[model samples]
Target: MRHGKQTPEPHEHGGDEGGVLVRGARRYEWSAAVGMLGRRRQVYDGLVALSGVRPGDRVLDIGCGTGYLTRRVARAVGPGGTVVGIDPSPSVIGYAATRAPANCTFQVAGAQALPHADAAFDAVVSSLAIHHLPADDRVTALREMRRVLRPGGRLLVADFSARPRHLRLVNLFGGMTRHARQHHPMADLADLVGRAGFAPTGSGDRWPSLHYVQARRPLEDVSAGAEASRP
Candidate 1:
């Protein structure tokens, strides 16, 4: 439905305001050089199946590197619905823009400070982006995702497994773990989402490394003990 204007370059979000491990533009360039090895399709199917994305749902994809998953989401949501992908890199958005269908748009934005208003989306999905953020930023980003969801909306995050033993050999190499140093273990990620006000639903790994977790905002405001106090 609504499309954001195309940006040629990523707007500077400033230096390591909480130690952002990966800068957007740099990451985009690197990804372009290396190429995505089925990551987009793999994560798209996993996230879609896990989130139960349906027709007419307004979805948001955070860190949508090149709109691969965003395009998939748009297809799932159909013409009646809309999908928006946000990434820190304008170059990534530019690539995404060319391939994006009419129902989807790509914007340059960070997870910690989403550009949308509260309760703007029906479902929020993030893949392989949280670990790139600093310890505190991860929590803040999660909270921001929750804030932008309507009541009972779901959030799904897929990323590398934090458990050292579970990682693939490539992930264990030098400096590969730099951004991932602060990656939350499955349990920790669940707890962090719970603390951010979502009710953790489930978590699991996709074989060797990638881990996915799902959580949902409560339909009723339970933070004030109102729901718990109810008989």
Candidate 2:
């Protein structure tokens, strides 16, 4: 998520100084919850495969909580490649950096304002992260992802589908539809990716509630795309 000043906090409705209180005023660590999500290796593997990462490629993992997916990508890219994991949480970034390989790096940064040059990455990927963003930040984040990608660079976004099958019970009983509604349906995600100047290639479900959309920037007019990112 962007974690921008314009967007409301996830627990803005009610929470102590620490984090969100989901049930009976139970305090939950937001970063810890996200870190646990990183251990869903099945979804991570599926997303990495869909991303088409290759040896010697340069990749950026947005909202890369704890670097689970980032390490997988680094292995795929091999020693010749470089993988950078960026997240808004400094604690997670610090933890990720400790375990990261020489070829991999972690940074504390938001997706909406990436600290990278235009056309810097061969592939840009995010998993289970975008849904946390507010509506406007989602667009800006998508555009920012496109801005950093090389011409014809691949884009892979993996998140829960709007009507998630796995979390159906939670959605119904826990009054979690508010969260579910934040997730984009397949069509909406495709449209957003397209509007961000990426050509939609395809999309598919990976594991329950986990789906991915694949896209790429056009090869022609790479320079124009770079110029457009300038202030």
Candidate 3:
């Protein structure tokens, strides 16, 4: 989630500040109380639809936690396709690896320093996790997403656009949603994606708990031509 502002006080997940809530909220016992709100399903289904994932395509899931969505994407992409799920947290990444399918792989890495070749993937996606970074890191991560995506590849990022409460609930419920700081930086996200060479053509549904932003990379720079304009 590219929240427009770059410097959030860093909503700590699993009780670690100065760090993007590394472990998702599910790490806590109370997460189930919060999850029944249908947030997970909304996010899971939304990303699947936004990515338009098909068989035989390479997909990258950044900040993947518990491999919940990663496993699903792996199945959707099928045999010929490959799915790579990356996250910086060892605890969560370890959990993700156990669920890895034959076509899916897991890695422990940071969004700003992705360990992949340029133009190596067909799609790059993240869910409910981007807001934990400082604004500058947010931009760097977007560029990394594009650098790893093949030309014409798609990107789907979903974040918490709004929360009923801010910092208080963030430390309390950060497991269920890392970017739970109540405030959203959607505008900054738009700018970061634009600068990272993406064209954001759609805004996802805004519910009381979440908001999503979707964009795609162009086949060519068309930096100064009408041929590049999106309808």
What are the clash counts of all predictions, listed in order? Answer: 0, 0, 10
Model 3, range 87-128, lDDT digits (tens) per residue? Answer: 766666665677688999888787877788777888988865
TM-score for candidate 3, residues paired by index: 0.75
Best by lDDT: 2
Using all chains and alpha carbons, the TM-scores for the candidates as numbered come to 0.73, 0.74, 0.75
Evaluate residue 88 in candidate 3 and report its C-alpha lDDT on the 0 to 100 scale: 69
Clashing pairs in 3: 3-185, 3-186, 4-185, 4-186, 4-187, 4-188, 6-135, 24-175, 25-175, 25-176
**Candidate 1 to native Cα RMSD, angstroms:** 6.6
Q: What local lDDT score does residue 72 receive in model 3, on the 0 to 100 scale? A: 80
Encode model 2's per-residue lDDT on 37-132: one tens digit a residue. Answer: 444566577678899999999999987766878998998999999999987765556556878998899887878778899889999998767766
Tens digit of per-residue lDDT, candidate 1, span 1-231 = 223453244322211245343434344434423233436466567678888689999999987767777888898889998999997766667667888899999988877778887778899988766665666666777777887888888888877665545333334543433333444454466666776778888988874366788988788843422222223
User: Which candidate gets the maximum TM-score versus the true structure?
Assistant: 3
